[model samples]
Target: MPNRQAGISFCDGPKEREGREGRPAVNLRTLKYFVAIADAGSLTAAAEAIAIAQPALSRQMHALEEEMGVPLLQRTARGVRLTQAGVTLYEAAQRMLDEAQRVKRQLAGPSEAGESRVVLGVSPTLSRVLVPGLFERCHRTMDQMRLTVREAFTPELLDMLEKGMVDMAIITSMGASADRPLALHPLVGEPFALATPRSMKMDPIISLAALSRIPLLMTTLHRTVVERQLRPMGVHLNIHSEIDSVDAIRELVHDGDWCTLMPVSVFKEARSDAGITLTEVSGVQLNRQLMMATRIEAVPSTAVAALREIVLAELARLNRLRVFNFGKKPVKR
Candidate 1:
């Protein structure tokens, strides 16, 4: 049977319980110390890192090995290395510690100051379009919340979410990945468009085939998403420059005859500009789905829920104003 504590359940499976009847019980603090030692690669280093005495750290590790009835670490002249059993326990302890921290946060709920802290991640492409409205709404309505925004591309954002660095992320959804057990909520579907200099005599629409011949500058992130969809059907982009910065790409496109392929929402501010012409690309349903992702194991705090609601509402408002042409139906991933 699993032991329930503070609304969290922990169970010792058959494999875990198969060992001895007489052993010291390992707790979270000990597991944390073990992890630190493993990460530090030396007991002295671990002790310094965790602010514990060297003797105490050594005793803890010895007791831990005895509890598991296996030598967790092989002490060498220089430092220490994990035994096979230690590797297994290290992996399990990491997961257990992560779960414990998450539960502790959940139990704590809002801060003592009555402010909800939420770390949000947004892709650079969407940050400009979303942040202003989000901040305004939060100030006007959600006054009791402290919001921290991290702006990065899709890949970096996903990595941040997995590491628990960000509470939630709005990113270009590449569907589910087996390695990342995240809960994704589809937010919007945005179509791709081409931004060309006004001097170039072109129609409002261009085919994917014609686009292949035209010289274009593209950001690395957008290129990855667009090419993943277009490449299979014998389509390739004429990417003359692979720049990761959107602003730099836009500046280059404006100064030269170069064009860039990006999500339509990315060029919302430049749509009516006299120097730039935003055109829709045809011959392919080239678009990216935006989704909100959180760790699957997370229990949404009041602040997290509030932040989500505010984001959805902000996107809805932008859609209504035709700021960006959002699809009528958001495709669920």
Candidate 2:
């Protein structure tokens, strides 16, 4: 009051200077408004789209520009055009909005009447045997639930889970190490068996040494698993064809001349003439751990929990049936 301007210099206080120099604070709602303005190309259109008064929208835009310490838009008689800084922010805002929408959808849970939607990813090999039965079981048990099954490889399925695209996955563990951010529940440890045409002359039990002599049609993706198990035993596989498709490999093996190594579950399918026969491989037990994978941060919904239980129960039942030739040993829950 004695001398108002005597002590208060323009940049005397740190807080006052900080307000002028610091970066602007932006939130999702502000970003949304900016995006609307950018898309509409004018305050009038943006205000109309957002159902806000033009004056209020203009005031908000002025405040944003002042806080940012930059001119974001160039006013025009017809409409508005974004400055360079505004263009950069617009692109970033668009991406943020897209991710926000995805997260919202994921968190929205189900719809009315306790009806839920669950997405399950399964390997192509497993999907052949599991999808139809799983679908039927899901529909029968949870009449209000909708289940979507996606068939993909282990790596692809893992990616889908991490991105929140799939709710759960049945995948084969590549090694002892488990992926972080994913919860792995071991469903079964399945041993590899020699699958040959029923007409092929082979022993009911084959040695790793004897397996090297057979012409094998195997998936190229499983070569690493095969080598890891066979190299220690000094047995080298003579792979005839490296096929990626499970159906193609099965068909090629069913030709009676080519044999393939697969999980015992693959041979359980009923066949008339060109049937497959599975023989236990002695000498070295090459086991693949089948795991139920879900995101570590995700808590399963009621429908998802029911689906998981159904899958585990079915796997246990299949194990008890000795479909994987585990000798009456049920899979550990």
Best by lDDT: 1
- Which window of ten consecutive residues has the lowest lDDT sum in model 1? 1-10
Measured with C-alpha atoms, the lDDT of residue 126 in candidate 1 is 87
Error of 1 at 68 (Å): 32
What TM-score do all the candidates reach, one by one?
0.64, 0.64
**Global lDDT of each candidate:** 0.79, 0.75
Which digits, one per residue and each the tens of the lDDT, describe model 1 over residues 243-305? 989878777877856898878777666333557677788878888888898888657778889
Q: Where does candidate 1 stray beyond 4 Å?
A: 1-111, 175-178, 270-272, 326-333
lDDT of 1 at 32: 86
lDDT of 2 by residue, 237-320 (tens): 998888888888877777667788887676666561247667888888777889999887656677678889989877876767
- Which residue pairs of candidate 2 clash? none
